[model samples]
Target: MTTGLLNKSTSLDMKHLTVFIYLLLSFSTPLALASEKKNILVFFIDDLRPELGCYGQDYINSPNIDALASDGVLFNRAYCQQAICAPSRASMMAGQHPDTLGIYDLTSPLRRTIPDSMTMPRYFFENGYETLSFGKVYHHHTDDREYWTDLPDVPGELYANPRSLESIALLKTQAKTRGVKGVALGRAARGPAFEAADVEDDAYRDCAVANQAINALQRSKDKLFFMCVGFAKPHLPFSAPQRYWDLYRREQFIVPERKLPQGAPLLAFTSWGELRLYQGIPQEGPLSDEQTQELMHGYAACVSFADAQVGKVMAELDRLGLRDNTIVVLWGDHGYKLGEYGLWCKHTNLELDTRVPLILSAPGFAKGERTEALVEMVDVFPTLVKLTGGDIPESCEGTSLEPVLKDPGEATRPYALSQYPRGTKMGYSLRTDGWRYTEWVNIENKKIIARELYDHRDSQESSRNLVELPEYADLVSTLSKQLDTHQRTAARKVKAGQ
Candidate 1:
């Protein structure tokens, strides 16, 4: 009888132990997941269009970015909220539309408009990650200093090369001699339109940015980090090392066709005042063929130079064995005109100006896949949050692209929107599967000033506007309704703080 009683007691003890083990695993699983949180690295390039090899440009030598696309999802159709720098950066970082941010110009501070908005880096920092910014991530003073653990070190001069610095100083002296005031004074101070110096990559600001990123990666192995390395190449004043310039022949460069869209309103085009601000460019007129070709060559050389810098930072990530646990995103602020439509900069609501290059690589996702889903810059914030196992805040106006990341065939949104302001008018453009529709509205009175419609199935160059044609009236009506619906929905979400 004593033996039987002992056996019963032992069985009961074994059952209790089994229950305890089960409870322990249930609690420990979450802790393990939390400890393995993935790190994030963002490469933000300035004025880069989808002209890389990965984006089907065989002429451009963008091997680094092409390899990255091979190991990740390359988005074929990704657009920014606006074509300009400051407003586009603010909108994407805040995960809100430009209308909500109230930043249409380069001078407006993001915090002045939305003081309480949680920026992408700020959200990550608040969630126990160390956030670091190396270059032009938030447009200078617009960056909220409190969110970053490390901010960029301001350089003594605008250009890293001594020659370029001297050129700028000379320009300033000339401007003072001429007594140019206000906006013209600032424009006069700009250095050469393009520069090719026989110096190392460190002679430019972008190379320094890459070096800083490499060092940060080496030190942040023990903790999760959100690092943003912004490269300022391929933008205006296309200054790059002579080695990059040697990669291409100026004679081989071809200037894009400068044909204006047929039947399109004059309001759709600009005088390209941005390009005229440079020293070598004509103050007011079309550039000569030789000048256009030179500019194109300079732009291409700068792109390849930026690509090399990207390669350096990526190599460091792999060497440190952080490739598996780190998510790397390479994106451009917006596209450049590149002499298209007689324009030089990104101030219009055209495809060449609005469509940006976006690539994302992460652990456990499919490799060498490309998606043609219509996505916007705003979607990046929520997508990162979802990947990092963070809560998607209600204030985020973008939809999470998690589904598209998992399956390339999936469609997240039906359309993508982009807008740009010209004087007192705002051009709101929409891109759908088959067509692009744009409506220019008077900001003060909300009256429609002009309309443009381009059929992508017919031509990608947007050679002609079909909105005025009588046969396409029904099609225009349908697209206009869709645009209105999207705008209303976005406004509502912004007001509701969604």
Candidate 2:
């Protein structure tokens, strides 16, 4: 009887051991998968518009960006909060709106506005990710240095052409004659608008930025990283390699009609004083046809040059074997005008300036898909957090775009809002899937000064203002109410600091 009891007891113990082993594997398998967090690679291109070959512009040579779009979901209607570099970038990085931060110009540092606010990079850093910025992640390089794991080493040789250097020398000499000196002198002296030198890509700053970013990727393959590689090209001076310029013919470029939208208020237009700073551009009247065509060609060439840099960085990411577990996002700070509506640069609340190119390529998301869903720059913060399995902060004003990434047919927001400030007046523009409506309001009085409504169903460009047309009165009223409601709600959120 004692021997039989011993055998029975041993069988019971074995059964218990087998059940425990099965339970342990079931629990640990998911835990191991959860622990494998994906890395983030962000490309911040300055003053770029959605005019690449991926966006159906066959004339533009952007193979790298097009390939990126093919590998991910391309957002067809991504709008910036503000159309300028500083405010737009600040809004994006802070995960807040420009109105929330009260930043409308290039000079204001975001830290001054919200000292304790958690930036996207800082959020990643706090969550045990190595965050690094390779180039102009912020409008000013020194703006948010403390938040980054490390900033890229200072680059060399902004311009390579001898004539471009000569123009800078001339501008400095002219400024010195007026008693300008120090930083003020440096600011006053500007270079030519366009340069295409017969030199290597490293002769410009963007190539160096890509090189540094590749080095960062090599060292970061083992760790989860939030790497931001910003490319400063297709921006002012439009300096690029001669080979890139040779990709396009100046005569074949299609120049827009050199006129503002009919029935649009003068306040809706900019003096385009930004373009006048360059040596070749005319200070006052419209550019001649030849000059316009050449500028177009230069812009296109710079776009191609920037695209090549993107290819180099992405190649390194692939070679490092990080592509499978990495999330890649490429976007511009804001859209460029490219002589659209006779405008030369960003700073308007128009579609050409506010709309940006946004692409997201990640493992397990919808691949080779295009989504017409409206997304804003602010939404990027929460989306990244969600993708990385981190908790989105309560202060984040934008919604997570994970669902849209999963199914390209999903709609996250009804419309995207963008704003720009002009002196005492501020323009708030609302873009829906079919139309765009804008209202310019006086800041002090809070009175609506002017309004603009453009029907974008027919064409992307705004040919005329339709706000006063009797047929669209109800639509205008509806959009106006929506804008008011959103602004009021956003204001309350900002005041509460949520």
Candidate 3:
């Protein structure tokens, strides 16, 4: 019988042999076993929103990401804990909410804030997996360097156009004439807000990130590796190759109607200082129609450009024959507002800012499914831990999403939560089955100062605030109580060191 089995195995092709090995390693074997551990590939996109073709947006050219969604479970209502890059990434990495991490701004050092916290990379490393990160895993490149097996390389220039650099130099020279010097001059000398350069995809920084990630995949194919490849396009300045830009017509882009939400507090809107830092954007006012169209066009082009990079790395993963036993997760750090409600960036507690794109594909799970289940970014850590057959930590505030991965229709939680800070006030927003309720409270006293209630069943965007209306009063009261209870429970868990 042994001789006959060996003779039959000799006739198997390479693909069949690989599948046999994968199935042998996968079936009835836990990921805790060192010899049979699966690989992890994570794509962390900077400032990416759910404007892809898979998310039902017809205009965006995202064939690669859409293909990923077809093979994975796409979370329709996934959200980040905070909209900003630093807090959202840190919260997801630490498997906690922004409130637990105590990190809200880009300047706050992660190690100093939570020195003993078990980060995702560190936890995986301790579980006998080789971990690697490339390009903008954290907002700062140097952050949590001690956790990874290898240090990530620093990314290249933001813009590759010679004219863009010349424009910055001109601005700097002009600033010198006005007596601005040193760091201030550099701050004042920004390039164009958007550029469509006639160059290859590799001319931009994200392509290099993709190339390095492909190389890493080639080198680490035989090992149990957890690798993160982050892309920095569609984030700022909106620079991309002309080929991607030529994929769309400028006239197809619609400028969002510039209007403030009715009854919203002054703090509910952002100044969009991030946009104003560019060369042509005005200091204060609605952007002109032409400028808005160009910015939107550039953003769409960058999305397609980033999608191409994703395709490269994913293709490499397949070529290396690692797809069957590997777990793949693609997510945006946070969503971005292209011009919704006249907002340009993600600093508010609005749905456009907090709702992110989350896709996960793993072995022995449902494929090509879209789930409306509400999941938070903080849940990623615990879910991965559970998928690896490890016990979740008691201190994790997020629930494991393993059940949802198995069955796309499973509901993991009642609602999704997000927060944003402005001056001395903190806004806590909750998204339930049909409504979004937000309350801005004084940070010191925790006294509610402003409230916003949007009925998602009626409008996609928050057209008007209905917190003070007589009809929705009872609903607002119920949601507010739920929010209070949720916060209190989280606080109690932290206090007890759970």
Candidate 4:
């Protein structure tokens, strides 16, 4: 189960900053080679929305994940700066945004930009962690090889719809298969299970990763460990075993309430159509609403599959008596819009595309606590530094949310931001408790485009576009300016001590 480990080229847009920023961050060793309290287990899932039993979504049966939430702080308002896989993972690992890291697309590896900056697990290793990663934690799979002692399985490399590729090749040969109109989910794959009874989450390559992670946790001891168990489920092939699929009766799952409003003023940069396609869903071709409910049912099953694998590792931590000392963090890279705004996956400024479920459970947070204050995935890096009792590098872009961990409702900032590059400029989304404000800026090109305003109270499902609403004009303008200050300061934060 060797993962796809390779070096990726840098994104053309932010290469200059990445080069300078990379040269700046140095992984300084922890002051004293002595005491540390918690082991960190990050259960990183892919393309999973917070539709688990804990988040109040009734369709999915995810008891293990829900139990973990009950035992920890469930962050209802968490997010990745971008929604794509490699880019999102890189941003979280590096504590940098796509714009700054210059790894916005899957084609580029984060290493090409800032090859020297320490990663999340590497920080612990510098301070005394025996770091091990299984599955996809960072984009450059090769980077994992540098930090991890073992990688049992690689992520999905099956192209041409390995989902349908086998049959498609067959179909291509059969003349009757000509002009195939519909896409098939295709045949099931094969993989090992946690237990003979453990349901397989489709024969996803990630399942093997989960099994390997369990094996590692069971065997690990002594030194403080940073273990990342990444489950590549719910992300694609959208494939999972049929048994769990039978559990979610799709008609019971409701499409979030949404309606295109009249006179909706189009903001200059609001992703009217681009984001849907980014998710592998197309811009046009409205789905003939149906037993697609069943399709969602399958998604629910994938969630359950991921949850079960998470359970496997948690069971191991407890088996090793590491639960009392481990800081367990569960997070999805970014939000996925099932059908909201007609978008299938991610890449949009809306809450559905950017928001993620972040839960931190440890000795200190043993009693359930949560933070309404929005936080970015980048913050997880600095937060780990604080947890490991290590010096935070001067160039880190995020603030430590340790304060919020003490009290889930505590504040780190007035708002949380998610920003990324599009063509020559950057698009920014600022999330406050009550509203979401966004703008697109390109200083070199002298362009500040598109504004987005979503009043969560009135429009939680994000059914209406209020960026152009006369009433919210002042609010949008104010937030747009604030975005400029936020981005500049953050970029400078990463650039500091260079």
Candidate 5:
């Protein structure tokens, strides 16, 4: 045997071989450890308002999220920065505002501005995350599925119809019901049938969504996984299984403490999306008390159903022993309008449409606290990167929430900005610590339509319009200039950082 190969049957020390193997593993283990980076689970839901237990709107039941908030920091004034799904989510993922990217409507794809740029998932993927999502993460129909590493289900199909093809009769029945009169129900079924008979939760989308989510958790790839579970509910059609509806007794549910008369905001016309019509169940002016209660009941039920699925995913994270090391973020894309501001749907500049529920829970996250400082959805991208020890993109406009997430009150953002394209009009809203300012610019007229200012310390619901008050005219002008300057420069400045 050659000198180097002369160890055949030689008396090598067992302890020495063991130590050598251990030494070899020490180097290899970190490479294996690369596979063990922190997992990121973003629990996203659709068209949900921040009026739940965590936001201190005790009108709804949200025990799971409430518990999560109790253990994590909750942002009292978290804004989505955009109202509609496509623009808002695009703004969030790219950490830029819609106007910055020029993704104003559903027709424009985000790739135009951020061509070859890293989005939220892509950024995580660049940082070694095995990114994926179930249900709706981006826009409902236009999201890019290629971003996910492994897509177990088509987002469009997860709830395009709740159940798989099993019973043709029941499926058709639900479809016809939703189709004929179900704008509030969300999308109608896309499947033909299902073999299984309808069970209480079987027909509900979140129930099936939860099942698939749990399975995904159990079979996650070794690399750090980012599972974005998008829950589409309480957005419309206002349908859930009867059980969730039963939870809210008709008698127990309460309507708005007070209703605004049609003429209260003398000049504010509700933009015709005006709450005066279709606030909830009724097709007419703000839902009658009974109908309002019914709509809220459906909404709460859908939220609860989604929450159960969230809990299942959380439990599985723990089951897989990924709890403390993993970062979990649950947020609604944008807030919903439940008969507030004479509006029902979320295409407005009011707080009802701009505010969303944001909860972050993980091992090192500050717990059970609130932040009055401004935070926007765009901040989500930077925060995730910071938390995972990844690079924050120079293009990201948001300030890293690391400072605030670590210390609730110590967080400092002078303002949070939200914007949207209204019907042939554009609106920008700015929310600071003590004042909320909004200005609407008609696209056709190219001039400011309506300007508003609310002193948050005195009026939280914004029931009174401070724009016309002579004493507050200076506040209105100051806020108006700030909003204009921000719109003209924020996006460009963010891009400049890159």
Candidate 6:
């Protein structure tokens, strides 16, 4: 009887030991995987439209960015929440719309409106990732400095060339002499719209950005990193190295059509105030054909210059053996208008201003895939969270694009929404798979002051507003209802603490 009892005790002890060992292995495996979490590289560009070779614009010399598109997924119809720089970038970084953040202009910081808001980088930093920012990730001084693990590097001056710098100094002196009203009216002496300086890549700010990013990658090999490198070219006063400018011939550039939309409301057009602020541009009239061509050439050259910097950073990732494990996302803050419909900058709700360039490259995803699904810039946050195994904050209003990333044919969102403010009235635009609808609403009473609709099937030009057409009234009503539904949904999400 004593021997049988002893044998039973031994058997029970062995079973308990086996269970303990299994549990240990299970927990340990997950820890190992977490320790090896993929690093993130967010390459952000300013004022970039989807005009690269990969996006079917072969005229632009964007080989590096094109190669990135080939290596990942390119979103052809991704739209920003707003066309302006500050509002659009704020929406993207916060994973919420401009309305939700209550930022409609270039002046207010997002935190000032939503003080408790957790930005995407803040969330990642909380998840034990080393976050680094270089250049203009946020709109200059509007950056949430505490979110980054370190102070962001200053996004140096506009031009590095001595001649360009001299021209800017002269313009500033002229502006001072003319006073604030004169400057506002563009009475200041204008500088050249474009400059092709015979300098090295580092002579510009973007190359320095690339170098810093590469160094960060090299040093952070043992830890997971979220590095955001923002390139500041292709904006206004398009300036680049002479090498990039030489890549394109002035004659090869074509001036865009300057005709105002036939039946569009006057509110849909801007005074082109931003362009007028630049030197050498006429303060009140349309640019001459020669001037337009020169400006276009400069813009394309800057794009190429930005692309080359992107290539350098990408090459460094591969050189450090971090390519396979790093997830790279290339995004433009907003699109620019290069003489499109008599507009020269991004301020309208038109497709040329709202549409941007978005590319994502992740491990285990198919390469060289392009998706035409309508997506918004706000979706970037949730997608990165899902990719990095991090928890997305409850305040993120954007949807994750993991499903689309896995299978490019998958349809996620039905439409994208963008808004711009015109004094007391607000223009809310909705871009669906087939149509674009906009309603200008009076802010004080929420009354729709004007209505504009464009039929994509009939024409992609967006040069005609079809709201008053008798045959399209029903279509307009349907789309207006759809837009209302989207707005209501977004409002509800914001109310629900999203």
- Scored by lDDT, the top model is 2
* Higher-ranked by TM-score: 1 or 3: 1
* Cα lDDT of model 2 by residue, 75-188, tens digit: 999999999999998899888899888899989988887888788888988887888998788887777677788786658666898877888999999999999999878767
- Full ranking by lDDT: 2, 3, 1, 6, 5, 4
Predict model 2's lDDT versus the native: 0.90
What is the per-residue lDDT of model 1 for residues 73-182, given as tens digits with 9 covering 90 to 100? 99999999999889999999999889888899999888887789888988998998999998778876438789888886843224556877787789888888988888
Q: What C-alpha lDDT do the candidate models reach, one value each?
A: 0.88, 0.90, 0.88, 0.69, 0.70, 0.86
Residue 252 lDDT (model 2):
87
lDDT of 1 at 70: 94
- lDDT for 276 in candidate 1 is 86
Scored against the true structure, residue 405 in model 6 reaches a CA lDDT of 91
- Alpha carbon deviation, residue 151, candidate 2 (Å): 1.1
**What residue pairs clash in candidate 1, if any at all?**
none
lDDT of 4 by residue, 1-498 (tens): 123222223344367777766565432223233434577889889888877788887667888888788788888888788877888888888787776777777788767877786777667766656788888776556764666655544656332234344544554445334543433212212111111123345355666777777777777766678888788777654556666666766678666433443333343224434323222333466444662354466567778877877887778778877887788889998877665654466766667777888888867653566557678898888887887667787656778888887887687877778765666766678888888877777748657665667778644565566888788878877887787787777667657624
Off by over 4 Å in 3: 1-36, 181-183
Q: Which residue ranges in model 4 land beyond 4 Å of their true spot?
A: 1-35, 153-165, 171-202, 255-284, 491-498
Ranked candidates, highest TM-score first: 2, 1, 6, 3, 4, 5
**Against the true structure, what is each candidate's TM-score?**
0.95, 0.95, 0.92, 0.81, 0.80, 0.93
> Model 6, 379: alpha-carbon shift in Å?
0.8
Positional deviation of 195 in candidate 3, in angstroms?
1.1
Determine which window of 10 residues in candidate 4 has minimal summed lDDT.
Answer: 187-196
lDDT of 5: 0.70
Q: Candidate 2, which segments miss by more than 4 Å at Cα?
A: 1-34, 182-184
Which is the better candidate, 1 or 6, if ranked by lDDT? Answer: 1
lDDT by residue for model 6 (229-300), tens: 888888877889899999999999878788877788899889788778777778798999999999999999
lDDT of 1 at 23: 99
